[model samples]
Target: MSNPSIIFIPGSYVLLPVYQPLFDAVSEAGYEIKGIHPPTVGLSSRQGRESPAPSMYDDAAVIAQAAEKLADQGKDVILMGHSYAGIPMSQSTKGLGKEERRAQGKPGGIVQLAFISCLVPAIGSSAASLLGRFPNEKRPLVSIDEDGWMLMEDPEATARMICQELPPKEGEAIVTGFAKHSAQSFGNQLTHAGYKDIPVSYLLCEEDLAGPPDFQREMIAMIAEASGRKVDVTSIKAGHCPNLTAKDETIEWVLNVVRKAEESRPTV
Candidate 1:
């Protein structure tokens, strides 16, 4: 593989701009990388107020469309997701793997599915199910209004959880960055299990408060059990929002991933 496109799916309610440093750095290093927004995040589209909220699949469609577009152009892709985005990103890879597309005489396809302190949910489980129903002990809580969008009861506290390593004042500012995302995206059961067929990597945020290290390990174990192979793992001593809290390190780590990916074959 050579210079594969790197597409990153941001966590729920968080917009793509937060990953600007990562994108800029990767691009500067001579690889194409994108940070895309899922339709459910509302500074953009959450449908009309009267319209039903978007599901995880809607998010999945946005991701799939962006990735396969690169694939169609004969560009290999490295699909990575952060936090809640893992669900949609994984679901997005339905028939877009390099081997799968090549089998159909098509060029380009996803070669890597990388998770950055993300939720690796089970098939038939929604991000909400794994989070809402069986959430990690350290995870913070946010309410959902009748319109089905999330409400952050305390953005300050939420920020602290995600950016635990940062100073309280600096972390507090990032609270405004979180948007009102569709609650339905969390509730919807995933119809597709894309990770099972793809080569996978996990960037474990050891100090994560949103999804603790134990939770991260559990998610990694799920893939190993299903695929009978351990996911390639990398550790970063940061909290949930490593991209925000540990920007420089995250950028360096991602660049390394790009270099290795470019040198390797598109095999899982």
Candidate 2:
């Protein structure tokens, strides 16, 4: 069997400049890994004024381009979008060419899509619209600090709010790098709607305060309805950045999806 290639897409505000930990985790399980580093508002950018909006389209382009490359190598690719990355990846895989689609082991040509605590947009919905539904009165549990560096506002409070299930050390690292994202990015509705026609699975972070559970349910239902197929769901008891704190377990669940996807492929 060929090694499964998975692409790690990071979530909003947080800096995943390096995906080696995730890469190592999946590789330890016998899978090859790569990451799509979309352009982001550097952590140094001033809050509100910085731009995370362009990164969405930028990331989608990265996903699409990466799929083409993997297909050329005859490797099966799985697109894993964490946090807000789901929006770009879900949009990117809609209408790929045969070779591009097959690289992800999607027999018809595209491999399956996975949403990692990432919001799945409604057919024409924007990320901002999804957040509006959540009450903003409470201060953010994680955010950027005064130096333009990202950090958790209150470590203990944040741990309780987002990663009560994770180890203290792992949770602390996540909060330490919790950068502030551009508010405008969420408001920009995805221009692509191909996700409705592609195979998708979603991983939910049960304790996430950023992309809350209620919203995840709403978004998942909407994606399922739009695709005319049920969206697969898996749960991880962490915050928005599970890939950072729950790497091993998350990769295990992802492998399960990959196996299922491989089994469902038709002999061509």
Candidate 3:
């Protein structure tokens, strides 16, 4: 079977194009690769936003829209998200499962849910809810005002922490590209628990300062404990932004998972 399409939902404060290297590599391998900048991130102004500002559900809707477009074309998808992206990406797959969609006479659906050093806040929980509960040194961008805007006093520190494994210049550029993300993204409760039915995999960044190895393990365990599913974990010695620091490795790992998911898919 051919490799399935892979859609990547990037983390907070990051532009989707930041994953260009990974996207190029994955696409060069003859697979469809796309990345989305969630609405919750990088909004120049929230003065025109909804009453409470964009939340995880808003982000999930964007992701689900992309997946639905591909699935409608009879293309299977491997939904992969990074860092804070996992929360919304999890909700994006509701009713988009192969079996579920097929029952509705749809041509395609999501095959797997993949993550790279991400947060999987349980249904009814928000990323803000998990703040300070886990031990992490590089927790720079946490609190936000009622305005729902979070600005980094020292974006340099965040760049160094999240993309420490990358080149010094590259890390600097990454920080420059960061925008003020919505605090409501952290506080809003996640509505869907898509992982309960979908197959899941995690690419753990062992040396991530922002999201420590221990925290990643706990997230994996949370999925296992809550869903009763063993999340396939592949650890990489990289920082939080593995797609940039360890670009080659990230591309290859993504290809492997997509291939596996495509191979195991039941024909509709």
Give the Cα lDDT of each candidate.
0.81, 0.67, 0.82
Q: Which one wins on TM-score?
A: 1
Candidate RMSDs in Å, in order, are 2.7, 4.5, 2.8
* Candidate 1: tens digits of C-alpha lDDT, residues 114-202: 89999888888877777764544555567777778875656778887888777887776676666778888888887777778887888
- Candidate 2 residue 28 Cα shift, in angstroms, is 1.8
Report the number of clashing residue pairs per model: 0, 6, 0
Instruction: Please give the lDDT score for candidate 1.
Output: 0.81
* Per-residue accuracy of model 3 over 150-251 as CA lDDT, tens digit each: 666566677788888777777776677676677778888888888888889999999998888998898899888878889999998999988888888898
Judged by lDDT against the true structure, how good is candidate 3? 0.82
Question: What local lDDT does model 1 show for residue 174?
Answer: 71
Better of 1 and 2 by lDDT: 1
True-structure Cα RMSD, model 1 = 2.7
Per-residue CA lDDT of model 2 for 10-90, tens digit only, reads 776555553567667667777766776565434432232243245466667777888767766766667887777888787
Model 1 misplaced regions, further than 4 Å: 44-51, 133-141, 266-268
lDDT-best of 2 and 3? 3
RMSD of 2: 4.5
lDDT of 3 at 104: 95
